[model samples]
Target: MTTESSCPRCGAALDEGANFCGHCGLALVAHPSPFPPGVSSLALRERIAELTAERTNTDEVLSPLWALLPLIAVVFGTFIGILLIFTPSVEISLLIFMVGSIVALALLIILNYKLVDRYNKHLVREASLRRTMIEYTWTRGQERGTTDAIYPYVSALESIDRQALMDEQPRSPLWSLAFLIPIVGVVLYFYMLYFLTRFASVHDDRWHAFAYNIHLSSMVNGDMVPPPLPKYPQERSFILYLLLTIIFSPFLFYWYFKLVDDPNKHFQEMGAFEDGFLTATGRALTGL
Candidate 1:
């Protein structure tokens, strides 16, 4: 049975050996390939594999160095102070103790700041990888919708890192001077805390939800950052702190530290699930 072939674009009957539709300008090549030119399954798999390896290396580098360096500083400062305290002469001992304390404190602050800077660089890399994953997903023609879901997380995290620097003297000399003032310093300190808390809350709310399946309390410590997670950005935690402070001084530190310890567990969980973002995106393109 002889039949006429119609143009896919405009339903006009396609004449023999027609290269394109006369009506709507659609190309009708005889030997069309299933995959787009220069875009193949193997190329996508290689890209996905490269991203997975890069992400793995990033996670390895994104360690708990920030958590430990402070404690190291504390130990060093305390050891030096103790040694000076045990010296023989009273007057000379006091002067040496003061000098040593100042030096140790300065070292601690500098070291901690350096560690934080490294961590911030890591956040930039992590953000870039996530952006790549989202973009690659769309590039494969497998998913619909925008790839703008994770940028807020990255920006919010950077905000936390920068805001935390206000606690340092060199980075914020005005703050150092302001703290010398009595009431105003106290107000400024709390304001900073409130701002950071809200920022942390936003990160946990928007990005962490997509990043993790486990709750913070259940999260494994020392696997990455130890718990206590950051300051509980919720108003409830703030009210609880106030209430606890009024009731008993001893328990305040406990709750405060608890609020301060928010270890990030999102990336660790990424490799844990087969349906997780990294795996899912790769599979969508490779079908493996």
Candidate 2:
């Protein structure tokens, strides 16, 4: 009781339940629709391209040069201060040395404030991109007649969205100002570690869910299989971070460097995945 259908790629007569077309040998799968009703594949392709561009075009990336400038200033100031201690006029030397130290400290604080603000913006942008993609999948999945299959992913994405919103609510730029207090600086460090840990957990979960959804979508549409998900680097444990910081105060500098570097690495990884996705889905989408 098989019904004849047309081959999607070759426009040749297809035997019912055939896995491959004999005329042109294009693998066939019964996909309901490439996109939702009233949504053309061209629209989806354009939107995807837009998102890719938005992510790659940004200068939100933290650079080591900017991040470490505070340390460099401190080192330079210290050398100058030491030289001043050897000057002939003791009172003048002490006054100049103190002034120079204060200026260096002020510069350090300003750089740190700016760095934290940049990091926050970078994370928010990442979240926005993810939520947009998830919403895209949900909208298309529902209208493509595969809502049930994607429901779990939708739920997970929703949860991540809620958490992100909650996290952002209290993340004002003033949060970074806590570093101004000598004792509160320690608390600020711990808070940063906690935030990074939470981000790692949420980010890893999102990657898996998103990857699986893409795989399913490609399979149903008879498109090329997507490459494996990129692996995110493991973040250090909270306790270990505290222990290391206590044992070696210089570890804080290293931690700050990693904070600036990790997201850059993440962005690169995302770029790699986006390239693969665009390629794999091009043939499946019309006019792509």
Candidate 3:
């Protein structure tokens, strides 16, 4: 003899494995399949998997290439600067260095713009993925005549929006001008460092931000953030090294790479945190 389960909503007898109550039509499952009339489960899974894999591959391939940009810039800039320094005519050296600085500055602007654009695109793609997951979860639950699991995917989308906003804002241009001042430039350099650290430390997952910032701080100090030149004669002597490096555009490029790499870490951290939140929320909402 078959046993019957009472409907949670209507108290009507429900057959085993029945999606809804035969008498009152109350749902039995938490998540009903929401696949459209034509789409198969396997097809949906394949599409999601493919998109996810593509995103992962893109990150893996682009990250290292971005990291290397600074090294390349520094090397090339140094070579050109060195040639200018050793060449017989001081006037020619100065001219060449000026031209080199201009070229480096232009390249930096272009690369920075491109990286930001790409980062925004990634965020958009992730947003779409999160939406798809939410839809699938809800449809599946509803089809089975149950309450839809809602929390995990919704939270994930929120996190993505937050991270995207952070990435979209341009870094302060005022700090760039600080390098022109005499003794103040040194103070400004540290100020910029503090600002960046604070910026990166945001988000619900603090540890991820902290760890990511540590790597970023290292990159900045080691490759991009230069020490302040002294104002007096003794300090002024140190300026020679700065001036020489300035002629080389690559060092600047390396710094740009370092800055760009920070965002990737930020995005990944946000994505993972959001996904976890969504899953937990879904389970809780479904009481499953």
Q: Please, what is the whole-model Cα lDDT of each candidate in the order they appear?
A: 0.43, 0.63, 0.46
lDDT of 3 by residue, 24-102 (tens): 7654554423345555323443454555555653333246465554455556688778888688988888888887776
Per-residue lDDT of model 1, residues 36-146, tens digit only: 446543455465456656655443433444444445556777886787767888888788777766765565445434433433443555455444433333333322211
Query: What TM-score number comes out for model 3?
Result: 0.42
Better of 2 and 3 by TM-score: 2
Q: Candidate 3: where is the Cα deviation over 4 Å?
A: 1-47, 53-60, 63-65, 71-82, 88-95, 106-114, 148-288
The digit string of per-residue lDDT tens for model 2 on 1-288 reads: 446688766789988778778899665653343234675444565677677777744525667776676677768798877789688898888888887877776766666566556556656566666665555565556546555455555666667666666665325666555665687786884785566544544554555565556556545444454754656756557677678989997786776666666666666666777677677667655435
Model 2 clashing residue pairs (backbone): none
lDDT of 3 at 156: 49
Q: Which candidate would rank higher by lDDT, 1 or 3?
A: 3
| TM-scores, each model vs. reference | 0.44, 0.69, 0.42
